[model samples]
Target: MEYLPNIIFAVALIVGIGFFARNVKKLSRNIKLGKDVDVSDNKSQRWKNMAKIALGQTKMVVRPIAGIMHVIVYVGFIIINIEVLEIILDGLLGTHRLFSPLGPVYNFLIGSFEILALLVIVAVVVFWIRRNIIRIQRFIKPEMKGWPKTDGNMILYIEFVLMLLFLTMNATDFQLQRIGAEHYVQAGSFPVSQFIVPLFDGLSESSLIFVERTAWWLHILGILAFLNYLYYSKHLHILLAFPNTYYGKIKPQGQFNNLESVTKEVKLMMDPDADPYAAPVEDDAAEPEKFGASDVMDLNWVQLLNAYTCTECGRCTSECPANQTGKKLSPRKIMMDTRDRLEEVGKIMDANKGEFVPDGKQLLGDYISHEELWACTTCNACVEACPVSIDPLSIIVEMRRYLVMEQSAAPTELNNMMSNIENNGAPWPYNQMDRLNWVNE
Candidate 1:
């Protein structure tokens, strides 16, 4: 009967971690549904990018207020969770303060954790106020309505509760240790939670133990729950940011990827001695059977990774010139739409036993619109603004490629320019000989 708590803890841990693993597997499968591309070049640069952007969060501080608050919450939450290791050990072995043997080191670690926990609570409160009360324009955008808004607020609440539970557990433990309660050892300092100790001053030893155990169990369970919740939330970036930044676009932003087949055709057209009807050589690097991306499957795996890694922070949209000028092209919405469609496709595949059934729906014209796609000036501001290296512009360009190449749906102005370029070798409706006439005029 004494081991029942340990058994229960073991069961809960297994279930929580097992569920999280399953979700991760599903996320991996969904991301892999997209086409593959070679991101093998620049290993050194990629590592540096991951380290600088994801680990160091260099881009996040572009706006000081939110970035500083985020760093506080981020650092504090991660550091405080180190105590979870101790909790897990204690739960499994039926020991209290399992690391108490470390003496002063343990006390110092606990003191630091207490301080961080308090900081995390304060940061979370500030985040809540910014989102709910202050109503930051980026946070209040159309894409952030409904579940997105609620999810954002809910995450803050979870962090708030978790920190409170940590302090409560620590305070009760401190009180119990002062009274020399059975199984409570003299260990660890609680700089922040020390103030919380007075609340338990009058409680009996048994009651104090009950409160501490309850808080401890709830805090650990909450962490587990938060872990699993990440799959459903935009917070998947918390895990995927490292890899996303590593595989992020390294080429110059203005340089678009040209179609291999189109490039070959253009080269042949310029060759004087090349046979017009010669059979093409079979090579490994071939253009896709279809031009451009009309759906999630048409995108490269990295772009899909970008979609999943979106923080929904709206920095991209806030920076986009098109969005700034009141166009329908919100870069944040572009990523959100891609992710939503990808999720829809994943669910469809899941329902049909691992094969995607034709759902008569696609990312283009359905989730995202023609107006939004056309509004983009290909300026790449969204790319620059993404803190985690998500390039929403890539998705926009791919969809635009599909619209132009597959459907011949390029705007009339673009069509006319393409025609002029083909016939006159310029984006003007003038003969080559007459092109220089503009100088005289």
Candidate 2:
């Protein structure tokens, strides 16, 4: 019975990690549902891009105020978690500050963690103010109304609570150690928590121990719960941003990828020497199942990765020309819709024992409207603004391709232009003989 606490901690760790791993497997499966496109061409350049954008936060700094605040939270949250390793060991072995043998080094590290914890709290508070009181335009967009707004605030609250618990745990431990309480070691420098230690000045030794123990347990368990929460929140970008930036689109922004089958048909049409009545010689390679993305399955894996990696910070939408012009297409919403559809598809696969059963819904018309797709100007502003290099434009173009090729439902003006191209070899209705008539006259 003495070992029961350790056993419980072990089970909780295993269960949290196991459930997260299962979700990761499901995430990978969903991403791979799309067609494969090779993004392995550039190694060094991809590395450089990832380092600059993901690690350096290059794009995020374009707006200094929010960027600085975000950097504080991101850096503080990451660095403070270093102490969690020691916490894990102490929990499992039932030791008090197990790294105390490292003595001064451990003290310095704990001191640094505490300082960062304070900074994280400050940053989180600023973020809350920005979202609520200051009311940033991007945060208050139509698409951010319901769950998205709640999720943004929820993460900040989680960070605030976790930081408070850490300081409380440290403060109580400091008081307990001063009284030479049993198993309360003289360890961990408390730069910020020292001020709070005075709050427990009048408490009895047993009550102090209760406070410390409760804070310690809650801090660790809260971290574990937060780890699991990433799957549901936009905070998953904290992990995916590196990979997303590394595999970001390498080609020119305006250069659209042509379908290979369509290219071959075009080549055949242009070849005058080719036999018109010859028997067709088939290639061994299998043809693509779909031309363009009507659903998530038709998109490439990189596009799916882009969808999942979205920070939902609205930077893309804020910079989008269509959105600026009051159009219905928010690039942020496109990524959100794609991710929502992918998640729905994943849930259906789970319910059916790992095989997907269609539910009469598609990403194009169901989650994202045709009007939204048509509103895009293909201006690449959203792509340029994404801090993590999530290419919402690529998904937009693929859906547009599906609308044009599969559905033949292009806007009337677009249809007219395409018809002009087919008949007169340009986007004008004049005959070829009349091409130079205006010049001569």
Misplaced by over 4 Å in model 1 are 264-288, 437-441
lDDT, candidates in the order shown: 0.92, 0.90
Least accurate 10 contiguous residues by lDDT in model 1: 279-288
Residue-level lDDT tens digits of model 1 in 193-219: 999899888999999999999999999
Q: After superposition, how far is residue 71 of candidate 2 from its true place, in Å?
A: 1.1
RMSD of 1: 2.2
Encode model 2's per-residue lDDT on 1-441: one tens digit a residue: 998888988888888888889878888998888788988899999999999999999988888988888888888877877789888988889788988888899899999999989998999999999999999999999989899999999999999999999999999999988899989889889999999988888999999989998998999999989888888988899999999999997778888888886788779888999898877666624564466789998888989888899879999999998898899999999999999999999899989998999999989889999899999888999999999998898888888888998889899999999999999998988898788888879
TM-score of 1: 0.95
Q: Model 2: runs farther than 4 Å from truth? A: 277-288, 433-441
Quote each prediction's TM-score.
Answer: 0.95, 0.95
How much is the lDDT of residue 255 in candidate 1? 85
Candidate 1, after superposition: displacement of residue 432 in Å? 1.7
